[model samples]
Target chain A: MSDPGTITDSGSSGEAPVTMLATPIRLDYQYTAGLSQSRFLQGIAQGKFIGQRCPACHKVYVPPRGSCPTDGVATTDPVELSNSGTVTTYCVVNVPFQGQSIEIPYICAQILLDGANIAFMGLIQELPATDVRMGMRVEAVWLPKDQWGLTMASVKYFRPNGEPDADYETFKEYL
Target chain B: MADSEVLRAPHVLEYPYVRSVGPVIGAFLTGLRDGRILGAQSRDAQGKATVIVPPTEYDPVTSADVGALVEVGQSGVVTTWSWAPEPKKDQPLDRPFAWVLVRLDGATTAMLHVVDAGSLDAMSSGMRVTARWRPAAERVGRVQDIECFVPEAANP
Candidate 1:
């Protein structure tokens, strides 16, 4: 074929021209969760919470970021933490947003898994958004084993574990 | 742990944006839609009217807004460019082309576009090129309205 980039006076200009275009972009990434988080993600696929313990402060971190933020030391020891934890703090989302799959008025909270120093953000469900409060105990609701992968998607969401509300003083400093 | 022992997952990030191209750019694209090339009339630090193609909202040097759209030539000089040996998806051309900054006649600033010179041997700085537009019917008010620029000497 000849050069495609050519001004050929062929087709008739009949219809009114388009003035606006809505551009949607999708970017694909092959995210390699490094050794520490890789072990954490791989562990979650098997229904386990693999955390790392800081050698200096002895504080365990869930989904370790390779080093201790406080001590500035490497976290070497892998500690298996409880799937259940206390909600350190939380916020009730009422405003809708793009790519929002969950229904409105849901509770998103910082969950401090037992024996882990750092709290991770998680969705707290199976209870009213207003009812989710500080120091509330919650447990992971794991998806089917066959659907598990090297991702946090293994745990669907957190629900009240039927335990009494934890004392606020125990988790207030971590907030 | 060994590198292969680590597991991986495919991660996708999507951003959907609907933004209005304001008057300055709207005029330029509208010109493209009607088979004309227009540049924005802005002033430089010296206060002389500088015409910029694919116009900017603010004066690039002074960052002041507001400009009258002025017509620029379809033919331009390639100021500088890099060769795209293997063009990726969504590029102006599928075949080998050079991503160029072409300074059109009657315009002070250069607009980035591509030059289809057939091969690297045909591409060079200061090479004269002309816009090879799409047929009138296919002219959308988008940058792709000008399909790609070709070397002026050969095409002429």
Candidate 2:
């Protein structure tokens, strides 16, 4: 919070070994991932995408919030979703600010993975920002097994999967 | 694919924001680095001259443009205080300290700061205190340039 916020990190030998801003405050928390989410994150740790199916409505939610919003029923049924998905929407980042991990001219998209009813945010990469479009096909780019953790960082980012863009009519309900 | 046990994810919410404190606050912090306390001079509803330490760009009372950055007395009275018996790591003092709102002399408004009196019994409202500064070399432009306020000699 003080002058230390401006200090550029001195990395370790042979590595960028940096804690972005080690400063006046660092908060720690042991977050308990609920039943449905625990299973979802475990699947992510194994490079598998898992969604929970609602008992009544039957809608599948990846990274389930434990219950269905409509039916008010617990989503206990597990559904394994494919790594491939469609970019339901996207935004190109141009303006820059301090502490931004990504550079200018990058794309952030909401990806609706196949077999899941809801869409989630993902970073889109490996192509020019202008090429990105709504309903564009994309797939997960995962980190190595040793680098995998209980966090979403296991999947580095999503890139164009060479599949044709999905028709807007098929995803209009999700939009 | 589903695990019977709930997962425990260790999350660290790290918010490292770099913000521009703006011209008004910038001057005040710069003054602290130079071993001086500056207050923003403004007028109240009745046009009475009022000064505030750690000032805002606009007057707190009248919401008018402030006039000048004037030097104020380093010594001040603790308007109110809450004692931290077990200090947190990020606090100015690792040992016990009192978070005090000091109305620095010549300033109508009180500024929040810590008073490093020996113990809880040593702190009270209306107690006089003076700035304890870090060495000139160590004084970066920050509120912490003053290590912590200590009991003024006049206090009894």
Q: What RMSD value applies to candidate 1? A: 6.3
Worst 10 residues of 2 chain A by lDDT: A4-13
Best by TM-score: 1
- Each candidate's interface RMSD (Å, one decimal) is 10.3, 11.1
**Interface DockQ of each model:** 0.26, 0.18
What is the lDDT for B58 in model 2?
88
What's the i-RMS for candidate 2 in angstroms?
11.1
Candidate 1: where is the Cα deviation over 4 Å?
A1-29, B39-73, B86-89, B103-110
Query: Pairing residues by index, what is the TM-score of model 1?
Result: 0.80
**lDDT per residue (tens digit) for residues B1-35 in model 2:** 34448787677877766556666676676666667
Worst ten in a row by lDDT for model 1 chain B:
B18-27
lDDT of 1 by residue, A1-175 (tens): 1211121112213333334656779898998778899888878889999999999989999888779999998887999999899999988999999779999899999999998888999999999888988999999999998998777888999999999999988888789
lDDT of 1 by residue, B1-156 (tens): 898987677989988875566656655666677787877777888888788887777777888873666678999999999999999987789999999999999989899999999999999999999999999779777888899999998778
TM-score of each: 0.80, 0.72
Q: What's the true lDDT of residue A31 in model 2?
A: 86
DockQ of 2: 0.18
